[model samples]
Target: NNKKGSNLYDYWGTDISDVLNQDESDLIVNLASNEYFKAIDKKTLKANVLNIVFKEKKGETYEVIGIYAKRARGLMVNYIIRNRLTSKELLKDFSDEGYRFNQKLSTGSSWVYLRG
Candidate 1:
């Protein structure tokens, strides 16, 4: 899963553009895949999905507090893939200074990291 260029589309079969273009409520109702979207609390799910769709509008950077692997894929797509940042660049920007990368996750899920 740490293969370079891997993204939400690769992990969840979800196209970021499609998710971004859809209405928020419509996305919430349609994105009910048990393998990925299941088991997430509704409020958190909505917030995460909306964050992906409207990230630019927020105009501020906030740390991803506690994202699971499935949720983290979307964020990787938003903050990494969409912005065309290489892994090295990501490390340069977010590593050290109290930000750690994949501190305690299994290898298979280590590609995702927390900013704070």
Candidate 2:
């Protein structure tokens, strides 16, 4: 729970689990719907998970999950899923608002990946 934000948090993975619940090995995954990653309005990207990929950490010998795509429009859907520690090195030079608005918008979404 985020007392500052006054709301329940929605972060996933080992880092949060380790620092917040140090002894717990349970992984907290925040699965988003398919449409969440697609282009919509300015507010859409703020509410979805764009993409995920393993990345190396900077100045360290480890890895961390990076969820840095804050918003987008078109080809801007390219997000990196790397170690939280080394994420900045890869995305530091990339702008978050560089995607061209997609011409063919997708609708009527359906369920694909099912997880627990």
Give the top-scoring candidate (lDDT): 1
Residue 48 alpha-carbon offset, candidate 2, angstroms? 24
Question: How well is each residue in 6-106 modelled by candidate 1, as lDDT tens digits?
Answer: 75435433344344445454332222233444334344333223222111112265333333433544444555555676334353243322334543431
Q: In TM-score terms, which candidate is top?
A: 1
lDDT, model 2, position 87: 31
lDDT (Cα, tens digit) per residue for candidate 2, span 3-68 = 433422323223333343443323222223224422223231222222322223345542322342
Model 2 stretches with alpha carbons more than 4 Å out: 1-16, 19-77, 82-87, 99-116
Candidate 1: C-alpha lDDT:
0.36
| Error in Å for residue 96 of model 1 | 15
Model 2: how large is the Cα RMSD against the reference?
17.2
Off by over 4 Å in 1: 1-67, 87-116
Per the 3 Å backbone cut-off, how many clashing residue pairs does candidate 1 have? 0
